[model samples]
Target: MNQIITFGEVLMRISPRGNKKFIQSNNVEFYFGGTELNVGISIANFGGDVKHISCVSNDFIGDTAISYLRKFDVSTSAIVRSNRPLGVYFLEVGAVMRPSTISYNRSHSSFSEIQPEMVNWEKSLKKGKWFHWTGITPALCKGGKETLLEGLKLARKKGMQVSADPTYRSGLWKYGENPREVLSELVNYSTVFIGGVNEMNELLETDFSYSNEDFIEASKQLMLKYPSIEKVFDKIRTSINSSWHKIRARMWNGKDFKETLDIDITHIIDRIGTGDAFAAGIIHGLQKFDDYKTMEFGAAACAIKHTYLGDINYANEADVISILEGNTSGRLKR
Candidate 1:
C-alpha cells in the first residue's frame, strides 16, 4: 500500500450549537479540525494508508485530538508533543442571509512555533509516496513556514508526489512577510496545485482575468513558473442563498481542461472541509481512476461533505462513488 503523508496543525473548534449567535449562546460544542487532518482522514476513510504530522501540546486536549485521528484510522506517529497550548477557534454558524463567522485564538500555539529540526523528516516520510499540505500551514507563523518547507524539500528528495491547496486566508499571515514570496517556494515542488485565479494573482503575482480562457492562460504561466506542477484544480460555487449552492469543479493538466456539471447543494450542514475532501478525493481517484474521472469524483466528494456536520468528510468511498454515478436520490439503502 502507498502511504500518503500530510503536514499541518490539528485544531480544536468550539461552535455554538444550532443557529444561535455566539453572544447569546451559553453552551458550545467542541470538534476537531485541521486542513491536513481533514485530508488525511478522508483518504483513510477510503481505505488509504495516510499519516499526519503535526505539533500538539502534551495535554488532555491533545489526547482527544489524537483519539479523533485514531478513530478515523489515520497514523499519528509523526505528531510531536510539547507544553504549548493547542490551537483553537470559535465558530458561529449562520443561516439564510446571515454569514458564518469565525474568531481564531491560535496565536503561539504549539504548531505555530514548530521548527524544522523538531521532527525527523526523513523517517516520517520514509514510506510516503505522496505528501500533502496547504497554504494555511505556511501562513500560521514563520517557523511553521520553515518546517513545512523542510518537509516539502525532504518529500522531493525522496521522489514523492506532492500536492497543495492554495488556501489563502487573509488573517493568518501576520508574521511580517509577503505571502506571495513565501508560497512560491513551496509551489515550486508541488505536483498538484488546488487553487484559482484570485489565488494566482495573490500568490504568483499574475494578472489573470479569471475568465475560462484567462484561467487557462494563468495556469500556463503557473506551469512555466513551476514545471513540477502536473495539474491545477478548483471547485466553483454559485450561491443561491447562504444555505443553498450550485457547485462544480474544474481541472487543467497543463494540456487539457476538464470540468464537471454543477450540482445543487441545498441546506449546507457544514462548509468547512469540503475543499479538503475534494483534494483527498482527487488524490484517491488519481491513484485508482483516469485523469478526467478525478474531477467528477472530487466534485462528488466535495458535494457530500457539505451534508455532514463537522470538518472531516465522514462519507466513505462507496457513498462517494454512489453519488458520482448519479445516484443522488437520497433514498434509504435497504
Candidate 2:
C-alpha cells in the first residue's frame, strides 16, 4: 500500500444551517474545509496512510483545524504555523434550480504566503507512493505556484504517482496573469486528472457538447496532450432544485472510458465537499481495484457525502462499501 500525501490550505467555512442567506440567518454553522484536506480526511478514514502538508495560522482557527485533522487520523506534522490569521468563506446554498453562491475572504492567508523553503520537499517526498494537490493551491500566490511545482518535481523524481484536481475557482485565481496558463503547466505533472466539464472546457480552450461521449472524447484528447496523465475523471450533475440533485460520474482510464448512471438525491443535508469525496473514492478505488467498478465505488462515496453536514470527514469505509454493494435504499444496519 502506498501512502498518500496531500498539500493545500484549509479554510474555516461558515454557512447557514438551512437555506438561509448570511443576512437572513442569526448564526451560521462552521466547518473546516479545503480541497486537498477534504480528500486527505476521506482517504484517511478509509484506511489509507494519509499526510496533509500545508501552512496554518497560530490562532484558534488553526488549532481547530489541527484537531479536526487529527480526529480523522490525518498526519499533520508537515503543517507549519505562521502569525497570519486563518482564511474564511461564507456560503449560501441555493434551492430549486438556484446556484450556490460563495464569498471568499482569504487574501494573505497563511497558506497563500507559503514559500518553497518552508517545505523540505526532498524529505516529504520520500517514502510516499502518491501525492495529491489541486489548482487552488497554485492560484493562491506566486510563491504557491513555486511550492506546488517543487512538490511535483520531487514527487516525479521519487517515482510517486501524482493526482491533481483542476478545481478552477475563478475568484482565487484572479490575481494571476491567467488561470489557464498556470493550470496548464501544473497539469503536466499530473498522472491522474480530475475536474468538472466546465473547468475542462475552460482550461483546455475547447467547448465540448453536453454528451457524455463528447466529454469523454475531449478528456481522451487531453490525455494524449499530456501523456503523463493516465486517467481523466469528471462528475456530471443535474439539479432539480436546491434540495434535490441528480449526479453521475465518469472516468477515462487510458484505454477506455466508463460512466455511472445518474442518481436522484433528495433532501441533501450539505452540498459542500462532495466533489472531494468523489476524488477520494476514485483514489481509493484506483489503488485497491482494477475494474471499471472503481467508478461505482467513487460515485457511491460522493452520494454518501450529500447526507453529511460537513466536508467528507463523517463518512467511513463501511458506509461506502455498503453503497457499492448495492444497498442504496438507505436502510439502517445492525
Candidate 3:
C-alpha cells in the first residue's frame, strides 16, 4: 500500500480522570489528537502506511507529540516546528444523561500560524496514494486555509485520491471566511465525500431533512454540483445518552445505496474521535472491499472507539474483523 497523507492541527487533550468534571479533579490526564491526526493514527494502527503533516511548537511538548505519533507508526517527516505553543483543548467527559463538553484554546497555536510557503506540497505528496483533510484546518486562519488549499490542488493534479470530511463547527469559523464558500471550493477537488446530509446542507445552503430518501437526494445533488466526488459515506450516531449509543452507516456510490446494521455501544469510555475512526475505516476498507462492506467496516471501527480512552482508535484490523464476525461479547482472549 502507498502512503496515506493527512493534513491538520495537532492538539493536546486535557481531561479529568474518569467522568469527573474540572472542579472535581485537581489533576488531569492528557493525550495527543486532532481531527485529521486521529484518522491518520487510526489508519496506521490498522496497518496502513500513513503520514501526518502539521506544525507544532518548537518545545518539549511538540517533541513528545511527535514521539506519540511515532509510537503509533505514523510518519511525521513533514511535521514542522514553530515558536508558537501547541494547541490545547479541555475535555470534560460525561456520564449517562450528561453530555461531554469541550473548550479549545488554539487561536495563536503553531498549526494555526502555518503558512503555504512552509511546506512543499509537491515533495510531501510525492509518494502518497490518498490524501485526507477536515474543515477544522481551514477554519483556523487565513494562512491555514491557504496552506491546505495548496496541498489539495497539488493532490488533485497528481491524481491522488482525496477524502474530504467537512466537519463544520460554527464556533471555529471566526476567521472571516465564508464556511460554505470555502468548503464548496475545497470539496470540489475531492474524490470521496466523508460526510452526510447535514454537512451537505451546510455546503449547499439548502434545507434537507434527515431521512433515508432525503440522504440519497442530497447525495445526488452534491455529486451533481461537484462531479469529482465518486462516492459518499456517512456514519450515523443515535445517542441514547452520554454513555450509550448506536453506530450505523449508509453509502451511495452513484449506482447503489446501502446501509449497515447498528453496532450498539454501551458504557462508552470516550466518543470524541469515533467519527475519525469511521473515516479511517472507510479509507482502509475501500482499498480491499466493495462499497457496502466498506460502510459496514466503518461502523464497526466507530463502535470500537467507544471502548478506548483516547482520541485515536487503537483497534487493529483483526479487532475490527472480530467485530465484523459478530463477536460483541467482551470475553478474555486468553
- lDDT (CA) per prediction: 0.88, 0.84, 0.93
Candidate 1: where is the Cα deviation over 4 Å?
A: none
Of the two candidates 2 and 3, the one with more favorable lDDT, higher being better, is 3
Candidate 1 lDDT for residue 27: 94
Tens-place lDDT digits, model 2, residues 1-334 = 3789999988989898788888898988888988899999999988999989999999888998999899888888889898988888888988767778998888878888899999988777666899998888888888878998999988987888898898777777656468888888888888988776676787778888878777787887788778899888787767788789878888888778778887668878788898889889888888888637678878888888899987764778888888777777887777
- All candidates' TM-scores? 0.97, 0.95, 0.99
Better of 1 and 3 by TM-score: 3
Each candidate: RMSD to true structure?
Answer: 1.1, 1.7, 0.8
Candidate 2 lDDT trough over 10 residues, lowest sum: 168-177
Model number with the top lDDT: 3
Q: If candidate 3 were superposed on the true structure by all CA atoms, what would the RMSD be? A: 0.8
lDDT per residue (tens digit) for residues 1-334 in model 1: 2899999999999998987888888898888999988999999999999899999988999998999999988999989987998999888888988888888888888898788889789889888999998999999998889999998998988889999887788788998988888888899879998888877777667677857888888888888888999898888878887799877888899789988898788889988898899999989988999878888889999999999888989989999999988887799878
- Among residues 3 or more apart in sequence or in different chains, the pairs in candidate 3 whose N, CA or C atoms overlap within 3 Å are none
* Regions more than 4 Å wrong, model 3: none
What are the per-residue Cα lDDT tens digits for candidate 3 across 1-334? 2899999999999999989999999999999999999999999999999999999999999999999999999999999999999999999998899889999999999998799999988889989999999999988888888999999999989989999999898888887989889989999899999998989999888888879899999999999999999999999989899999999999999989999988889889899999999999999999889898889899999999989998999999999989977899999998
